[model samples]
Target: MTESLNSALGTISSVVWGPFVLIPLLLGTGLYLTIRLGGLQFRTLGRAMRHAFFDGDEEGNAGDISNYQALTTALAATVGTGNIVGVATAISVGGPGALFWIWVTGLLGMASKYTEAYLGVRYRVVDDKGNQLGGPQIYLKRGIPGGFGAALAFLFALFASIAAFGIGNLTQGNSVAAGMKDTFGVDPWITGVIMFVFTGATLLGGIQAIGKITSAFVPLMIVIYVVGGLVVLFLLADRLPAAIALIFTDAFTGTAAQGGFVGATIMLAVRFGVARGIFSNESGMGSAAIAAAAAKTSHPVRQGLVSMTQTFIDTLIVVSITGLTIVASGVWDQGADTAATMTSAAFTTALPGQWGGTIVSVSLIFFAFSTIIGWAYYGERSLVSLVGQWSSLPYRLLFTVVVFLSAITEIETAWLFSDIANGLMALPNLIGLLIMSGLVARETRAYLKFDPKLKKPKLSVEEFTAAQMPNWK
Candidate 1:
């Protein structure tokens, strides 16, 4: 029965994430937003980086955390198993061309990220406890207007709440467990218990706590992984040119059977590449918008810019390093047993014995654990939107339980199921982004006109919202 269910999920995942469905919708929505926004993500990335890493909170800004904290929190959720195992899986199943498609999602999806983040903050509301509420749940309903919007909002919330367990919970825990077992021979059940405790402790403090923890460690973890990957790349410098060519060539033409890599069609490459890319950075999934909505900024555009940097960091830099290292190290064509350990194996091949694997195992542990904390907040918020604030604790507790359960289990099925849920979660949010692209573009233009460099805006957020978005909820 389990095998049967896994097969069914694989088929459904293919259809949901295939060329005809989410591929076009995701890419088209992103392309449309990029044009509508006049490539704001490209033009403002430097300033966005400054805001995300250097800027402090605006005085009197209505938010629970600084923009930097929010950015890191979102990064915590994103820069995890996807960057490690997901990239490897993409290359293993889809070929190196998958990395090229991943790049496409990162570049184009930046616009989608900006639009969703802008709308998330634009339509955000203050809950009864004074916590901020946002993301597709708030934006789709309030931004769209009428029953259709409400339905979309509900579906987004439902999918997000469930996706939290799959992508955010199971896949993350399973990866950490798998990496540890592969590298250190640690038992999965032991890892599960320890992770359960750590995740639950972090969840008890809520988003504010998660933000503080992620902010402090997320950058450090990323730096460690990037530096380790760079060492591997340097060792494999001779293979760099050929690897780059293969990625581009295979992107258009399918990869033929080679070594342990059975083979992949052009369609498979595109599908897995896009799927893993979306899984890695989550540019269009709208999950990161939930974190962006909590940022302290004077304008939605400011927060949106900072928020979009999450994708740039996750995919453009981090995912690139992992994928390049895997391809260049010549471990990408290894069989399924290497999928979870591909990055580690690549690093091990370049560095002295045990050191490379140790770094990767430690990084995976931190990455996956941080993701669990970050996504717990997303799940909590989704439940709050569906039920109320009353569901927060219960949801957190349940999420912790699932982290343990997922760690001790096999995750091939989990990955496929999570991909489907992620696509479903993105569907309503993507529609909302496309439908509201004009409004997002207009608001962004209006804001940039007043403060192009992210300096002090001429108008206060209240004044700007009241004057420009008169009917804004």
Candidate 2:
């Protein structure tokens, strides 16, 4: 039964993430959003960075978490194994040139992420008890019209909930356990039990718990990984230029099999690069929107702009550094099948002794932990959307169990489950983004036109809620 199930999942995954559909859909939607937003991702990058870091919540802000906490929570989910393992996989299968396409994905992904954040916040609602509720579900209902919106919203919630089990819970646990086992020779089951306990303890406290922990953990882990990568880059400074040239040339001309590399066509480079890049940044996935909606901001567009920086930090900065270090160290072809170990080898080679390998292993543990922390919230919110607040406790418990199982189980099947679930989740969410793209453009333009000095909202939260209440037009 297990073998058959794995076979079915593999077939489904290939179909779901096929080069003809999912890739083109992701890339095209991002490009469309970039044009729709008039390239605000590039133009307002400075403002976005300021808002992400320096801006504080409005006095008596009406939300669960501050904007920074929300952004960090979202970042925690995004800046996970995808940065380390996913980058190595992309380069190994697609060659060094895959880095260029991945960069392209990030650049365009900024617009899609921005729009996802914007719509999430714009349609968000605060309960009488002050609980915040929103995401692709709310926006699809508020921004899109009629039955189509309602169905798509529900589909998104369903897929997100399912996807969370694999992408957020099981896959992460497996990665964490694998990293720990590889580094310390510990039993994977022991690591699994520890993660089960830790993640459950954190999940039991709810969104506030997630927000605070991720806020602290996310930045620290990112710094650790980035500083380690930078050390490797500095050590291989002379090889950096050649590594870069190889990436660009391979992107278009194809990479010839050299060393352990099996060669990759240009098509393979674009496919894996775009796929892994999406997995890394999660720009159009709509998961970030769930966090963005919880931010304490008077204007939806503010949080939207602020949240877009996640892609910049996750893909452009963190993932890029990892990719560069792997390339510069000339380790891309080594350990071809074991991408994570391949990445670790690069760092180990560049830094003296076993310190680099240790760092990568430690970083993975933290990254996977934080990703689970963030995804716990997403899963909770998804259940809440489906079955209301009553579902939160049961969902968290179930999520924790899956995390434990994921750690102890073989990870090969976990990868297929995660891919299929992710593709399904992205499908409905991306459709919604494209359908309501006009709203994103209109809302963004209106927000940008507002005077920076006039931060006061014309309508209070209550007034704003009253004005934008859902109506089927």
Which parts of model 2 are misplaced by more than 4 Å? 1-7, 127-129, 452-473
- Residue 116 displacement (Å), model 1: 0.5
lDDT of 1 at 471: 62
TM-score of 2: 0.94
Q: List, residue by residue over 1-473, the lDDT tens digit for candidate 2.
A: 87998899978876776788788999999999999889888999987897678756554556789999989999999988888888888898899988898999999999999999988887887643467888997788767889999898899899998889887877788888888888899898999999989998999887888888998878988998999899889989999999999999999999998888999898889877887898889889899999998888777777888899999999999999989999988989763567757778889987888898899999988988888878888877876888787788898899989888988876667767877888888888899999989977875675566534324464543344344433311
Report the alpha-carbon TM-score of model 1 versus the true structure.
Answer: 0.98
Best candidate per TM-score, number? 1
* lDDT for model 1: 0.90
Each candidate structure's TM-score, on Cα atoms with residue i matched to residue i, is: 0.98, 0.94
